[model samples]
Target: MALFGLFRRKPHERQGFELYGAAVRAARHPLFFARYGVADTLDGRFDLIGLQVALLIRRLHRDPDPRGAALAQAVFDAMFADMDFNLREMGVGDMSIAKRVKNMWEAFHGRARAYEAPLEARDEAALAAALARNVWRGAVAEDAPAPRALAALAMATDDALAGQGLDALLRGQVTFPAPRDMP
Candidate 1:
């Protein structure tokens, strides 16, 4: 073996990856597009996954245990790692992939922060406005009810996650409320 391995690194924390997968699957539920009118385009899909991931990360941050912080970091690392791999698979050039991923990270960060205040205050109207702008790119009106429906689902999701124990999440389990069950 050569003195320097090409890319020796610690194995990813499986728990984070599994959790992210759950978030992705939840984001892909058909009702989001069929009923709520979220666009079925790439950007729409990305925003959906980012929203779900943000909610999970929000819940992760609430745990007082030291592991919560570490777990949250792992989730973020896993998400970007997967994004990098996906970009490479899609034939994005090495130079361009970094820039693209950076842009996505920034978008995700901004979207997460935008939801934080409204989510905290249970402001459905504000949450609908943010979702309408981000998920629909402002194509849908804030009072149109589609975004408000998503806001209701989001609120239910936040409540569902809040009810789950930290121990279950640490063990790589998360539960998002079923969209159909939401008003």
Candidate 2:
């Protein structure tokens, strides 16, 4: 069972931005990616997950319309890659931790709409909350990487949307500087 399995308590529904922010915060720990040297550089892999979360929020926040299932599959694949690299290369010296990560990956992959609407939102909120509760309490093993990869996957989808210029759709109104009259 996953560490949070013991609780068996469900969390309340939340806004997409709130969910994304929480996920980012949950995965923003240096000790996590720092372990395997995958994050040894100054690029700050520690915030990679958080960035991913932001990207996802930016996308979904911009576009309320549903995306094709293929997009979700691609995201799952990318997340699988990141999770593997993070655990195998940058994670602390712990096999169980790796197993847990693998379990999460499998579970996430097995899901159909990992990035779809209501289901996607549900997953993000649950993972973020669980990560926050665990990482804050140090419930996971030492040097054990946090489960930010999930959030990263969610964010990756947002990146695709942004690439398609869909960010403004969800971001709402923007104030651009007008040209000076003295031009």
Candidate 3:
């Protein structure tokens, strides 16, 4: 147990936390809520962060290097830690935090699966529908611009990430597309 405790804190953990923080910062871009019509509500914010993280995870999963896998796991751990902190900050009872975090993990997994196929196919229409259903929770107006715009943003984001090197990502550096570049 003593040896296990010593190995629990890996060096990559700090970098992962920083990278996850970068993802969160990108997701909080004001343009998403102000211009793109992504709600400023908690759920909307979480969905945006989930989208960004999912993109990073997808990129990591594609890399053949073992370091990519390690970093991916670290980033995932950081995200869950952040979620736990957020729940605590929101005054969730200690006993309920575990259940809430589990639910959040399930939600994130479902969103990732829903996004993967359309993103891989680069199917704009399918991406738009998925974004509408998940991001907007199907409350968006039929003529709303948010769905298409957000889908475009996803594609642009993927492209931007593709341009980034795995080393840079492992160093806790990532860049998301500008809102103006979408659509």
lDDT string, candidate 1, 14-53, tens digits: 7899889999999999988888887898788999999999
Give the poorly placed runs of model 1, Cα more than 4 Å off.
Answer: 1-12, 181-183
Of 2 and 3, which scores higher on TM-score?
A: 3
Whole-model lDDT for model 2 versus the true structure? 0.40
Error of 2 at 164 (Å): 8.6
Give candidate 1's whole-model lDDT.
0.88
- The C-alpha TM-scores of every prediction are 0.91, 0.30, 0.93
The Cα local distance difference test for each model comes to 0.88, 0.40, 0.87
- lDDT at residue 142 of model 2 (Cα atoms): 31
Candidate 2, superposed: residue stretches over 4 Å from native: 1-68, 90-100, 106-132, 138-183
User: Candidate 2's error at 12, in angstroms?
Assistant: 32
Q: Arrange candidates by TM-score, descending.
A: 3, 1, 2
TM-score of model 2 (CA atoms)? 0.30
Candidate 3: where is the Cα deviation over 4 Å?
1-8, 141-143, 181-183
Best by lDDT: 1
**lDDT of model 1 at position 106:** 99
lDDT accuracy of residue 109 in candidate 2: 32
**Tens digit of per-residue lDDT, candidate 3, span 1-183:** 788898688757987898889889999989898887788988999999999999888888888888888888888999999999999999999999999999999999999999999899999778888889888899985236888888888898888887789999888888877676334
